[model samples]
Target: MAASLAAKVHYLDITGEIDVFEHASSLDGEARQANILLCPGVGFDVIPTDCLALALKQALPDATSLCLGFESHSLKSPGTAKTTVEGIGQGTKIRREATIRTEPMGVRARRIDFGQGERLAVAFPWGDVSTAYKTTGIPSITVYVAVTSSFRLAMLAANLLAPILRLPLVRRRMLASAGTAVGPDTEARREAPTYLWGEVRNESGEVRTARIRTANGYDVTIHGALAVLRHIMEMRDFDPGFTTPALLCGASLIEELPGSGKIKIR
Candidate 1:
C-alpha cells in the first residue's frame, strides 16, 4: 500500500485482518498527501457489517455503544480455515471508548437474532471492531459470531489450551488436518446466505436494531470488492485516506451490492 501510494495510485484490498487494517490506517497522511485512497476490508468480512454499523449510527446518531453479530451458513475456504488456525490462541478484540482492547477468548457471549430466532453468539476478533469504529465513531464495539454447541466446546478447548495451541507445530498440524480446498462450490455458494445483525444504544438509553441478509461469504467478498472498485472508478472526488467502505460510499454500499438484502430495522 505504501508503494502504491508512493506510486500515486489508489490502493484497495479485500483484507479482513485487523492488524493489516490498523497498519493501513496509520498511513492516512501519506495516502492523503498522495491523493489516493487506502481502503481495505472491502469484502464480506467488514463491508456488510461496517455498512450496517453506519446504518445503525444514522438511526441513532448519539449511540454510545454498538454490538454487531453475524451468522453464516457458508463453508470456509482454505484461506479462511488457515486464518482460523493462525488465530487459535489469539484473544478477543473489542473497541472500548474509542480504544482497542484485547480480552480473553469467550469473555463475552450474547443472544442475537439475525432476523431469525435467537442464537448463542460469542465475541470474536472480527475486523469490524476496528473498521466500524472508524466508519461510525462509535466508542464501544463488539462483534460476535453464532456458534453451534460443538463449535462452542471447541472454542472452550482452544481457550484452555491457548499456550499449547500457540505452538507453531500445533498450528501447522491443525492446518494440515484442514484440507486445501479453495472454498465453497458454486452450488454451496448459491445455497448459503449470510445474515448480519447490529444494535446501537445511546447514553440516553435509546436503542436501534437492524439486520441484513446477503449472499454467501465468498460471493459477497467477490462482488463487494468489485462493487467498491466500480464505485471508486465512478466517483469524481473521494477522500484520500484510510476509510471504511461505508465511510467511502455511505451505508448504501452494502445495499447496492448484487446480493445484499434490504436493511431491516426494529
Candidate 2:
C-alpha cells in the first residue's frame, strides 16, 4: 500500500553503453518504517557502479541517513544473484569493465527514524539491501529486492524460519539456495510465450542474449526475455495491456518460442 504519489528521480554515476532515464519509485517495505526507492525496469540502468554512492548521497539530506558503510550487497541481479549474505567481505580492487548492475549487487541503507517526513537520499551505495531497518511514520526506506530465484528462495526460507531464525536460540537461519532451474517443465505449459532470462556466456566470453519468440518475427534475445518478463510481471500490479507502466514487451506478437532458437516457456 502507498500513501503518496511523486515521480522521484535517480542519478547514476558510471560509464555504460547509454544513459537510461526510465524509472519508478516505490515505498516498498513492511512494519515499522515506510521505505522508498526508485525502481527501474529490467534491461534498464540500475545505479551505476562508479558514482552510485555519491549520486545517492546527493539524493538524501543529513537527517535521513541511519547507518552508512561500505558493503558488498546483491540486489541488482535477479535469479540466483539475490542470495548474497551481508558481511565485511573484501572485493579485489580491479578495474571493472562491467557495471554493478551486471552482477547481483546491493546498496545498504543506514537505519534512521523518520516521522512522516518526506526526504530524498543520495549516497555511494554498497547496493543490495536487506529488510532489517523498520521505522514508523514518514515514507522511510529499508530495502528492496528484485524478483529472482535466489532472492525468492532466500525470502521464502526466511519467512518460514521467522523470529526463531533471528533468535540466537536457533541461530542457523541461512537459506539454502537451489542451484539452477536447469530443466524445462513442459507440463507446466503457459497459454502465452514465457520468458527465460540471464546472461549467456557462450563461445565468446562476452555476455550475449537469445530471446526466441516474436509473432511478428522480431529479434528475441536474452534482453528480450527480460523485457517480456518485466512486462508480464508489471501487468500483475498494473495492467500492461491497459494501464500505466504500459506493457511494451510486445506480448501480443509472442505466442511460443521460435523453432530455430531455444526459447523455454516454463
Candidate 3:
C-alpha cells in the first residue's frame, strides 16, 4: 500500500533556512519526570496511538510510554474491555486499560502512578488531558487526529469551532451525541488520512510545536503514526510554534507515499 502511494504523490522539498522561534514557557521539573501519555481517540483512532508509541519506543529506547483509555466518551464503555496492540507478534498482547473523565480545562486529573522503566498504555478522548501537562507533569504530548483529504478545511473548521465547542452546554450535548454515534465501524466509513500535531517543552521555558500528515492513503493510521515518530525523531531544537512537516523532515519524508504532497504552510 505504501509503495503504491509513494509513486503517486508529488511532494516539494522545503529548502533554505527553516525559521524556528522561541516561545516563553517553562516545564515543571516534576512534570519532566512523569510518564508519557498517549491519547489515541476512541475506538479506531486508538490504533494509531498504539502504533505510534511502539514506533517511538523503538526510536527512543529509554522512553516509557502509555496508551490512554477513557470512561466518559469511549466506544468500549461501562466495563473493562480489551484492545489489541498492532505491529507486535500475532498482535495478541493487551495493555491494562484505565478510565479518564471529561472535564473543563484546568481541572485536576486523577493521579496515575507508574513504576520505574515501565511502559504502560491507556486510552482516552481528545482534549481530556488538557491539564495532564500540569497534573501529570508530562514534558511532551503528541496528539493524532484523522481528517479529510482537504486537511486545511478540516483544520480551519476545528479552529473556528473550538471556542463554540468549549461552551459547557454545547460540549455536553456534543459528547453525548458522539458517545451514541461513534463505533468500531467508524473507521470503515472514514476515508481521509491521519495527521499528528504535538508540543514539546523544555525546562528552560521553550515550546516547540509540529504538524505532520501521512504520505499514505486515506484512513491509513500507520502512515500518520509513523509520521509522528519521525517528527519526534527530527525535532532536535525549538521551532516556530507553527511549521510544516516538510520544513522539519524534508521532502523525502513523503517520497515514499504517492498521493502525499509537500507540507502546506498556511
lDDT ranking from best to worst?
A: 1, 3, 2
Clashes of 2: 41
> Could you list the CA RMSD of all candidates, in the order they appear?
1.2, 20.9, 18.9
lDDT of each structure? 0.88, 0.24, 0.30
Model 1 TM-score, all chains together: 0.97
Give per-residue CA lDDT, model 1, range 1-266, as digits (tens).
Answer: 96898799988888888998999889999899999999989988889999899999999999999999999877888888888888887888999989989887776888888877999899999999889888888899999999887777778778889999888888888998665756789998988898899999999999899999998888888898998899899999777889988888889888887778899877
Best by lDDT: 1
By summed lDDT, the worst window of 10 consecutive residues in model 1 runs over 175-184
Candidate 3: segments with Cα more than 4 A from true spot: 1-44, 47-102, 105-124, 127-191, 215-218, 221-266
- The alpha-carbon lDDT assigned to residue 221 of candidate 2 equals 28
* Per-prediction TM-score to the true structure, in the order listed: 0.97, 0.21, 0.25
**Top-scoring candidate (TM-score):** 1
Task: State the local distance difference test value for candidate 3.
Answer: 0.30
Q: In lDDT terms, how accurate is model 2?
A: 0.24
Residue 191 Cα positional deviation in candidate 2, in Å, after optimal superposition: 18
Runs in model 1 lying further than 4 Å from the true structure? 179-182
State the TM-score for model 2: 0.21
